[model samples]
Target: MAFRLRASLERRHLAIDIVSAIVGHVAKADRNFRHELITAFGEAFNNIVIHGYRDRTDGMLDVEAEFSTEQITLRLSDTGHEVDFAGLKPPDLDSLPEGGMGVFMIHALVDEVVYHSGTPNVLSLTKRTAAASENDGH
Candidate 1:
């Protein structure tokens, strides 16, 4: 299954709600997976709004979701500033920084994170479904 959402940064919650509903429907049997994916999705959206668009509210965000028997993949694209994915590092847990944790949290929650910088920067996240993990004897 696949779903797409396009909305301005100002309407982020609506987009999140739509995506969350679809994710819930597809992964209803696995509450933990749904929660983690939704949290990662929220973090990704927030990054595009806060870092990419600089909270301008006028920038548009494009989100695409693909679900298979084994995994769910999400791609978020924005026309805002390109991200420096190479420079992003996990937050220091001991120091407890106030900001710069969204990317780190997204990395922790998802199985794969890929970033492409171009006219429209794209961040893709993928996570295997719980059933898939069980099938693999994980």
Candidate 2:
């Protein structure tokens, strides 16, 4: 009941294809994915490409997506310079900043995001079903 895909950061464009494939598989398990989630997945991929590999070199980006009964988790790992999360601040979206919005977008769109540091920075983005949340309200 587990599926996986991996690729290099050097060919970051391939991330989109992997995302789509994961989305379809996750949808099969839980039939309630919103367009917002789709957009968030795209942003998450971009985050790894930019933040995780923003240097003059080639590296590897490893992504593993897990779908459970109630949620889907995406783990993006990169072998680039370690990210210093201590200095992260929300960008001003009103002024139409050209960059630095991906993390904010991912935070706002996904239900949960967790980062674990090691040789490669690993970020896990989890999304809960709205249907499940609505059921909890009752």
Candidate 3:
């Protein structure tokens, strides 16, 4: 399923809930996978609203979620400022930084993540289900 949302912080929860429900229905056998997917979705949405749009309600966020028998793919695009995807690094665990961990968390939970810095910024995240991994002999 796919939908368009306003790039507003207030709408973050709604977006997360919608994606969670869809993911849950598509991949109901694994609760952990569903949880991780929801977490990644929330982080990506937060980044778009807080950093990309700078809390501007005028910007729009486009989200598309595709679920197959083996995996799920989420594509999010926004018109806000592009994120420096290459510059993102995992937080220093020893220092215990207060912020800048969203990208790290998103990467950790998902199998593949890619960010594009174009006229309309895009973030694509994909995760293979545990069942799929096992079937592939991974």
Candidate 4:
């Protein structure tokens, strides 16, 4: 599935819903997996709007989702400012911090995550299903 969404905070929910539907179809009957995907995608989208576009409503975000029997992949592209992936480190849980947890949560929830910086920066995330892991030896 593919979507071209405006980079606006108000449209975040819509993006999440579309992602949920695609994830559902891929996971078959795994509602829990579906929920997890939604949460991760939601945070990622919010980050794009807040940090990438700086909350500008005129920018556009391109999202493309691909699914297989074992995994789901999401690619988010935007023509906003490029992200400094090197600076995106996992938050320190030893002490309480007020902000900067989105990237951490996204990395934790998904099996693999990647970011490419360019004219249209792209963030690609892949998550393998629990069922797929269980059936690996079969």
| TM-score of every model versus the real structure | 0.82, 0.72, 0.90, 0.88
User: Scored by Cα lDDT, where does model 4 land?
Assistant: 0.81
lDDT of 2 by residue, 1-138 (tens): 223333334454466555656666553334336455666766765655566566634565667777755567877776666654332688887899997776777777777778777777887877877655676682
Residue 86 error, candidate 2, Å:
7.5
Worst 10 residues of 2 by lDDT: 1-10
Tens-digit lDDT track of model 1 for 9-111: 5566787677777676564337778778888888888777777888466677777788765678888888888765443668788997998877788888888
Clashing residue pairs, candidate 1?
A: none
Encode model 4's per-residue lDDT on 1-138: one tens digit a residue: 899989898898899888977887774437777777777788788788888898466999999998986789999999888755433667887888787877777877787779998889999888878877677752
CA RMSD for every model?
A: 2.7, 3.7, 1.7, 2.3
- Ordered by lDDT, highest first, the candidates read 3, 4, 1, 2
Task: Write model 3 residue lDDT over 33-138, tens digit each, in one string.
Answer: 8889899889888888888888566999999888886788999998899875543667898998998888888989898898888878889998888888798898
Question: Global lDDT for candidate 1?
Answer: 0.75
Candidate 4 ranges with C-alpha deviation above 4 Å: 85-88, 135-138
Against the unseen true structure, what C-alpha lDDT does each candidate score? 0.75, 0.63, 0.84, 0.81
Q: Which candidate is the best by lDDT?
A: 3
Instruction: Report the C-alpha displacement of residue 46, candidate 2, in angstroms.
Output: 2.9
lDDT of 1 at 136: 76
Winner on lDDT between 1 and 2 is 1
Q: Model 1 residue 111 lDDT?
A: 82
Clashes of 1: 0
lDDT for residue 120 in candidate 1, whole number 0-100: 85
